[model samples]
Target: MNETSNNTVIDERSDILETLAKHRHFLRFTTRDLTDEQAGQRTTASELCLGGLIKHVTSTERNWADFIQRGPAAMGDFKNMTEADFAKRADDFRMLPGDTLAGVLAAYEEVAAATDKLVADLPDLNASHPLPEAPWFEPGARWSARRVLLHIIAETAQHSGHADIIRESLDGAKSMG
Candidate 1:
């Protein structure tokens, strides 16, 4: 490849990697130095908790990487799926106590690996994928594989921000400099 093309590829890969790193960092941050109760504790009135966030992220990764991309979804996708019917399974996404920190992290890693492989194998970022759950998603939209990856990254980053605040409230731990 020419220097310009090489640089662009490098920049794109770097951006993707950085996004993944940030997600991993926050997962670790949220789980750090917490008792089992604290990890599972719903610190606020909302459904947010350190463990729940981890499970939610894992599910999100599987959705974007597998359901949207037409690949195999990791086991963590079923975190809170018992109450869901077949139709509800198509749209329901929540975390349950069964989704322990370790299990969720492992599932996230598996989905992340699949995501990396998908990105690497794609011929270009413009490559599009079919949306089986299209109606449940935004209006007038199908997503490219690249778009799904970026969306996962963006979603993780946003949840990480929430994790940061919750972690602080729990014990005042700051992000590493």
Candidate 2:
């Protein structure tokens, strides 16, 4: 690659890494002062709580890293999955009974590691992967692996903001910074 193209690639990668780091920072902050109950408690009507958000983020990372990029054949027949599949996945976001705060954190850590490996091993930012049969994504449109990574980073950051607000409302704790 030419110097300019090389610089662009470096810049893009840096941005992706920075976004991931920001999400991880906020996630850690949200979990900072919470007891196990507080972490798992749903303060509002929303399905997301601190722990739930962690679980959701971790699962999303795994889905993107393992299923979406690598292929979905191992997970079973996703060929005919529809909007219901998306809804079912969304409905599964809640923290189940016996899911501990530590478990959620550990899962997030593992997902983060997997995501790091995916990003590191990716050949190019523009390489695209076919979106599985899901409503949220176009059926045949390809998604760049870099874009997927960035999307995960963005999604985590957004949920971490929610966690910060919920954590504050649950108790007067404020660690959003």
How much lDDT does each candidate structure score?
Answer: 0.66, 0.75
Compared with the true structure, what per-residue lDDT tens digits does model 2 show for residues 80-141? 76898867677446667788788889878887877776666666767666666655567686
The most accurate candidate by lDDT is 2
Q: Candidate 1: which stretches are off by over 4 Å?
A: 1-7, 71-98, 130-136
Candidate 2: list runs displaced more than 4 Å. Answer: 2-5, 72-92
- TM-scores, one per candidate: 0.74, 0.82
Query: Model 2: clashing residue pairs?
Result: none
Clashes of each: 0, 0
Compared with the true structure, what per-residue lDDT tens digits does model 1 show for residues 73-96? 322333344555454443223345
